[model samples]
Target: MKPKTPRISAVDLFCGVGGLTHGLVRSGVDVRAGIDLDPSCRYPYEANNSAVFVERDVNEVTPAEIKSYVGGRKGYSLLAGCAPCQPFSTYSQSGRSKKRGLDWQLVSKFGELVSQVQPDLVTMENVPQLQDHEVFEQFLGNLHGYSVSASVVECIKIGVPQSRKRLVVIASKLGALEIEAVGKKGNSVRTVRQEIADLPPIAAGEKHADDPLHAASSLSEVNMKRIRASKPGGTWRDWDPELLAACHRKTTGATYPSVYGRMEWDAPAPTITTQCFGYGNGRFGHPEQDRAISLREAAMLQTFPRDYKFLADDETVTFSRLGRLIGNAVPVRLGEVIGEILVEHVRKAEKGTLRPISEELSGRLF
Candidate 1:
């Protein structure tokens, strides 16, 4: 008879609405707890996963505190952190300083906790642009004792219904590690229609009577006219001349064509951002609707489960808060891929079939 596989446990930092935790749990990892600075995340994170939520900033969390949650587990320990990406995002590049910024420092802090706790596995997800920063190098340096591999993964390749890209890093102290490739273009790619077309329709400035969370924000008279003229796969260029914003007429703003656009039903969505509920932000307008994609639709594009609840019965939904939580989450599909990779690595190691870094470097590890 085969021996039972040893259980793997995890502690998620900056867990944010528990997207990573949800995916990991689905992939068979026993996630004990999640740590985050946002109190708003407590409800959703705790509600959806088996883990407890610790509402504390990553910077303020000590190794002892982290150990309290993960220490008693009997098997492999994993630490996962998806630090905020805004500091290294292309949109914020011009203003970022060489000196460590707050978000960058959070990545460094993640390294600190990893060094102290010395978990069997470590994984991090962040903007692809973070690969260019010095802090990333330092974080890599801190993992010298472990075998590490990283890649910039496209979200759509991993079954997410959006064209988002993220930098993913995985390291293992037990043996060499390799993350499976995802986001291959072909019949496997998920589309906007497949992700959200089934929802009962709701008009602009309205909420579904049965599901209040399936609500869209109100649009002003002028903006409503602009959305009416927008086309799927087309930009503001399709709008009537009078409906164009003044900034769009200028040469500088002419480059920002994705704003005031609509998603193509047959293709993946543009990257969902914190402002996705606004018609003027990216190509967030529903393909056939007269308003921006609803908050529920935005979460769906991020690969969150359709019934994933962000608010409670008595809690009022606010566009800004929920939008940020949803957009900032790691796509649950990508998290599953990560969890699968780690589990595979451990399985191979136990069976004595795992390849060393030197042998696997050329074939895997981007």
Candidate 2:
């Protein structure tokens, strides 16, 4: 008889648009359900993956509810959480005021759930800066008996077509756990051209007749002129001095050269943000088009499948809403990395081939 398939059931906390769920499912994990507070995510999270979408805050969810999602599952239980990362993101840190209040507490709450649920395995992905915060220490403290391994993963090195870095953590109650490595054996980093060049071009403010999310946001005449002069991988400095924004004329604004820039076709795209749909946001302008990258292109940079559905048949495509959803999502490709590791971690544990927890955490970060 063929060897039995490894049994792994997962419940995703703060699942945005099912990025993590889709990745996990793609890697052969049985993702049971996704929990999030956003009603807008309900359609996509459930539609793309074979998982129920629980429309509720992570804080409101009890261990019992999470257990029910994994009820009667056989081999291993996994709890995945990618809490709202804004609080720990570098952008939020560089702003005038520090991001705090309820969002900060959410990390604590994620720790609390891990302590309460005590699943066989746990995974979390977040901004790299989070590892520096005290909350991260508290989160580690909650894992009394688990061996944990965390590293700052370079997205491009992991087969993602974007220049992004994220903190990925895996903890297991059984023996030692390690994320299976990839992308080191002549695996070339994917590029913007590789991911989105095939997409039919659309003008600024125009939506594709066939794909609603392919629409680009409209630009003001001044912004249009600026984009027309912008070159791939070039910044607003490429424009005539007369075309410069009032702020760009100042020394402080000169330091923010990434704004109003165009992405290079051969390189990985800049980190996608909530305002990526706007021409003025980051280096979001298309390589040669006089328009910002559309909602669909932004999603593709985040490693969302081309056909990934973000809206229902009757729903209208709103730029701000969809941009927030797409930008805030954890890259689906990274999620697959997380899933592949956990599956192998389980397989090794069952065969008694894993190391002890004490030996594994010595050099965890990569």
Best by TM-score: 2
Candidate 1 per-residue C-alpha lDDT over 22-77 given as tens digits, one digit per residue, 9 for 90 to 100: 99888888899999999999999988899999989888898888788778777788
For model 2, what is the error of residue 42's alpha carbon versus the real structure, in angstroms, after optimal superposition? 0.4
Q: How big is the positional error of residue 162 in model 1, measured in Å on the Cα after superposition? A: 0.6
What is the lDDT for 228 in model 1?
Answer: 87
| lDDT at 358, model 2 | 77
**Each candidate's clash count:** 1, 0
lDDT for model 2, on a 0 to 1 scale? Answer: 0.87
Clashes of 1: 1
lDDT of 1: 0.85
Give each model's whole-structure lDDT. 0.85, 0.87
